[model samples]
Target: MVGGGALVRKPASPVGPLALLHRPVPEPPSSLRRGPLREGAWRSPLRSERTATLLGMWVGVAFAVCFATGLLSHLIQNPPSWFGWPSRPVNLYRVTQGLHVISGFAAIPLLLAKLWTVYPKLFEWPPVRSLLHAIGRLSLLVLVGSAIFQLVTGVLNVARWYVVMPFFFTTAHYWTAWIAIGAILVHVGSKLAIIRIGLSEPAAAEPPAAAVAGGLTRRSFLTAVAATSGVVALTTAGQTVPALSGITVFGQRDPRLGLQGLPVNKSAASAGVLETAVDPTHRITLDGPRPQQLSLAVLRSLPQHTVRLPITCVEGWSATADWTGIRMADLLDMMGLPEDAEVTVESLQESGLYRASVLAPPHSRDPLTLLALRLNGADLHIDHGYPARLIAPNRPGVLQTKWVSRVRAL
Candidate 1:
C-alpha cells in the first residue's frame, strides 16, 4: 500500500485436490547428496535426451521385428487349432527365423547405446518422486532385465551352447518376450510427450568444456552406434543369405559344411539312432486304413520320385538338396487314407523333444512332401536319416523328423 500499486494481493495458495502435486520437491540432506547424486555429476553433452530418444527408436523397432518373427516361429512349432500354416513358398520359415535372429543381434548394439545415453538418469536425486515414479522405475528394471536376458539367451542358442542355461531356452525366451514387450509399451506411453519434444527440437552443439577432452559429439555417437549395428547384421545375416556365407564369422553352422553338402542340426549319432537307422531289420510302419510295415528294401522297391528341397533350420542356415523318396500323398493313396489326412511322424530317437512331429493336412498332402530315403542321389547319409526321413516343403528342419520309424494317421 505504501508503493504506487493499490489493492495488490499475494498469489493464492494451491487448494485443489491435486495441490500436493504442485508442491516443491523436498531437498536431500548433505550426506545423501554425494557422488552421482551431486548436482554436477553429469556434464556430458553426448548424453542429451535427443541422443537417447533416437537410439531408443531404433531399439524399439528392432525389438518389434524380433518379437513378431519369434512369435511366428513359436506358433509354427506349437500351433493351436486356430492356426494353419501354408505349404507353398518353400522358404517362408527360413526367412522368418532368419529375421528373428538377425533383428535380435541388431538390437544388442542399439540397446547398449540407448542405455549408455540415459545412464545419468539412473542416479537422479530423490529417486522415488511419486507412486507412479516408483512403478515406472520398477518397470524399467523388468525391461532391462528381460531385454538383456533375451539377447544373451538368443546368442547362446545361435551358438548351440545350451550347457550354461538352466531352463529350456525356447520356453524361457518366449515367456520373457511378453514381459519385455509389455514393459516397453508402458515406458513408451509414459514418455510419449518427452519423446515428441526430443525428436522435434534441434540438437544444439554443446559449448566446449575444459574438463572433458576427446568426448564424442551426439551426432558422431549416433553414427558410430548405427555403423556398429550394421556391421553386426551384415556379418550375421550370412547364415541365411547365401551370397554372404563366405564372410559369416558368427554363424553356428555352415550351409555347405555338413553331411551330403547340407547342414545338419542334429546327427543320427547324437540322436542315439545311429545303430537303429542302419539296422537291416529296420521297418518303417505306416498305420492307416491299410496298415503296412515295410522294410528299407521294400520302401526302396516302391515308386520313387525326386524333388529339390531346401532343409531350412531354425538356427538360420539352409542348404538345398535333391531328395528321393516316396510321395506322402501317394503313400496315403496306397494306404487308402484320405488326401487331407493329418499324420504323426515318429523318429527312431529313443528320447528327445523332436523325436516326433505332427504334420497337418497341408504338409501331409503336399506334392513335395516325401518319406525321403536318399539325399543328392545315393542312399541317405546315416546322419541324414538313413532308413527314411520326412521331407516337406516350407517346414522347419527340426520337424523334418530324421530316422523315421512310423507314420500314424491322426
Candidate 2:
C-alpha cells in the first residue's frame, strides 16, 4: 500500500524497459569530450612559430625564382614591341624555362610543410576577430588554392596529360600565377610584424612529452621536407640538364632520344600535316611586296646559312642542333621588304591553333631566324618538319612553325 506522498515499487525485470531505464547512464569517452581551447592543443611540439617562419622564407625564395623565370618564359613566347630578347646565348630560354619548372616543383613540399605547420590556425575560434583578420584569412585561402592549382596543372602539362584539363593549360596557369603572387604579396605585407618576430626568435627545444614520444623532431622534419624537394628537382631537372639524364626516372622527355636525338612534342601524323609535309610538290609561298612561290629545291639552292640554336619547348625540354636554312633577313631582302618589317610564318599543319606565328621586327632582322631545311647536318626528319621549319632564336618551340608553307611580311 502507498500513501499520497509515498512511492510505489515495481518488480525488477532486467529485460523490461522500466528496468533498462533505471540502469545508470554510461559516461562519454574522453576523446568524445570537448575540452577548453588551449595553446598546448593548438600548437604541436614538432611545429612552432619559428619553424613556420623558416619554412615560409624558403617557400618565398622558391616562389621568387619560379615567378622570375616564368615571367621570362612568357615574355619569350609573347614579346612586346619594346622587348627584344637576345639570341646570342642560344640556351637562354632553355635555362630560364628549366629553372621555372624545377623551382615550381621544389615549392610543392615546402608549401605542404608550411601549411601543416599552421593548420591549427585554421580552426581558431573567434575566426573573424576583426575586419583585417577576416581579410587576411580570405587572402590566405586564395593564395593556397591558386598555388595548388598552378602546381598541379603545371605538372600535368609536363606529363602531357591534356585530357585532365578543361581549358588551355598555358592560359589558365599563367593567369592563376598572377593571382597567387598577388595574394602572397598581400599576405606577407599584412603579417610582416609577426613574421619578423617569429624569424628573430630562436627555435624552441622539443617539449619533454614530445621527446618521450620519440617521433620526428622539428629539425628532422624540416630536413626531410628539404630532402624531398631536392629529390623532386633531381628527378625532373634531367629534362633540361643532360648530365642528370641517367637519374631522371620521372623526367617527361629524354633529351638524347627523339627524331634526330631530340624529343618531338608533336609528330607529322598527329598534326594532320603528314600528307602535305611529305608531298614533293609542296612549295613555300612568300607573300610580301614581291609575292613569290619557290619550290623546296629552289629555296635550298639559295644562300644557306648554318646556325646552332636550341629549341626550348614550353614544357621545358630543350635540345641544340645545327640547323641549315636561309636567313629570314635574307628572305626579306629578296622580297624587298623593309628591315623593320614584321613577318607571319604559316605552317602546313592547318588545324592547330599555333599553325601560324608572327615574328617581330627584331626577330625578323636577326640572322639566327631561319627557314630550316636540315638539322644536325642531315635532312630534316619527317617528324621534325621534313619540307621546312621555322627555327628562331629565343622563341618557344611551340612558336617554331613546322611544315612551313608560307611567310608573309607585314
List, residue by residue over 1-410, the lDDT tens digit for candidate 1. 33676775788776676566455555456688888888779878687668878998999999999899889888888999899899889888888888888888988999999998888889887876755466667778998999899999999999888999999998999999988887788789988988996798686654365433677767778899999998898888888888888888777767777777887788877999878887889898889899999998888898999999988888777778999999988888877887678889999998999999998879989889999999999889888888899999988889999999998989
Q: Highest TM-score: give the candidate number.
A: 1
**lDDT of the structure predicted as candidate 2:** 0.83
Error of 1 at 3 (Å): 32
What TM-score would every model get versus the actual structure?
Answer: 0.91, 0.86
Per-model CA lDDT versus the true structure = 0.86, 0.83
Model 1, residue 256: what's the lDDT? 73
Candidate 1, residue 243: the lDDT equals 86
The candidate that achieves the highest lDDT relative to the unseen native structure: 1
State the TM-score for model 2.
Answer: 0.86
Model 2 agreement with the true structure over 300-405: per-residue lDDT tens digits: 8999999988888888788788999999999988888997888889999878778899887567888999999999998899889888999988788988999999
Alpha-carbon shift of residue 127 in model 2 (angstroms): 3.7
